[model samples]
Target: MPGIDRVTLTMITDNYVDMLLPDLPNVTRTGLAHHFDPKTECVQGENGIALHVDVRWGRYRYQALFDTGMSHQVLLHNMKVLGLEADEIDHIVLSHGHPDHYGGLEGLLRHRQAPTPVSAHPDAFAPRYLRLASGQVAPYFNYGLTKEAIRDSGGLLVEHTEPLEIGPGLIASGPIPRVEEFEKAPTDLSAPNALLHIRDGKIEPDIVPDDQALVIQVGDDGIVILAGCSHAGIINTIRYAKQITGRDRVVGVFGGFHLGFPGTPRSKTDKTIEALRELNVEVIAPSHCTGMESIMAIGEAFPDQFMLNVTGSKVTLQAGTQPVVDLDVEARQKIGLQ
Candidate 1:
């Protein structure tokens, strides 16, 4: 995929809220207020983020709630409930391989009014685990959504083929080469049999090739990157975004952070923050997997720019103007891990 020319980001999801980010203890707002909902407390609340793409690369890209948030992190339930038609929007760019992000794909397939295509890395079905306080356990990384699944779901399965044009300025990550020395999914996660695997002589190493990102060009607004879990290292993904599409003006970020792994080192978190600051991004909305410590350091480094996302948080992007966002207090009560 080539580098995007430009793009903006629009966050869509549930109404619940919480706090893992330590820096913004004062921050009580997150999640988005829906525009399509009834006259309930939702729409009446502040309007969340809506992105405009006058540029080619930064076009239509939306995430529909594909399942109930019962245990799902990012539910496509709202998207399904609205019965929203799958317009000729750009691409269904996913953040990572977690159940919250991939679970929706199943629902999206069942409800689409027209043909839809999804873009992701080849390792979307690899086995992943989380090291909770109790012990190591499985967290949803085994849904088995493969190339075959895409065909079965009634949508086209487009793998991350470099900074390719999903729709004009919207691009996806290809191979995220980690230049930053500190960042790597420290857990014993494995990738699918997709990419090259080799070792010293026997040529044996677990290939985790499913990690990728959604890079949308917001025209004059710069780039809006949506990450899944960032297991492949956020910096590597950003660097790949810059290299693949030849464009690097990251304005904001959205999706799972995967930072607070039980065994993850403090230095890794600090180094990630350092790289993020060096990236000089405009806005940071760390959600899902982004660990608490990671978010705070970022907020400390770039206060006005770094924030958290929950069920009711929303952000809007306009040309030559500051981004507008709203956090719904009532909606915050409704969020939970599905």
Candidate 2:
């Protein structure tokens, strides 16, 4: 499959804001130093994910936002520090109904100079919850955006139950098929509620069917998948991408792998890493909910292919090549709209 000339993924907002990798070649750091050290003027990190994907095909350009992080202020702060224009975002793709992924939509829409198209699964608006260790049911709080809110923000809400061609070669996996035995949903999570499911005459864990991923085919570079949380499992996401695109080779994968946190089985990460290596995934830029143990294991195994993906990190994939792009305050100021 022929790939695009280049595709750029900028980590607009992530759980970690990198400030030490200033000398990491093409890697960029912005608006985070201030958060680390109040003395410095920079942005702070948050528990969420948001990315600005810029793809170029010949002379054509396409831009989209993968997720909107958990906080509007954090998203806005990072964008301001990165000199990102909300108006430049042609499409807003939500990974799932998770608050951390879509909570900032209203803020973004309010700031946008024009209404943008927001895409997600129909179940994204369904109430979600996390079953606690104490067996108590608690609502996943702080959800800020609703379908109505999106419409009020001048966003065209496009909900889909199947894969969609969002841009030139960019596609969003609508409902990932869960075929992997080890890749099961977090035992505690349930959309709406477990009780509600039981009352509705059903007994099954919520698989987060709304969980989806963003895909871009880089000419000759294979497929680059941007997974928001990998709640459906990273391996499942990758395989689904290959299945849907009919492109077997995966050049790069970034975003949350959901490998972190207690109660998560080690075999899950181990099996995932084994599968990724088998697939010959050239680059693994894991961040956000990917966890520290998983990151270290992947880094140790992949070595040269492992790259840190935090706030302000920019990865550029082109035909037969991939590189970390730099992002600084100066660079941000110079880049207005376009």
Candidate 1: tens digits of C-alpha lDDT, residues 195-229: 22222433223334566676765555466676666
Top candidate when judged by lDDT against the true structure: 2
> What would the TM-score be for candidate 2 when compared with the true structure?
0.86
Predict model 2's lDDT versus the native. Answer: 0.78
lDDT values for all models = 0.50, 0.78
lDDT of 2 by residue, 1-338 (tens): 45567888889888886565543455555534545775545656899999999999889899999999998899988888777888888999999888789978888998988989999998676655556557677764424657888998889999999999888788999999988888976443343233211214444465677899999988864788999989788999999999999997788899999898557788888999898988888778888888878877777666557776778777676676444332232322222211
TM-score of 1: 0.68
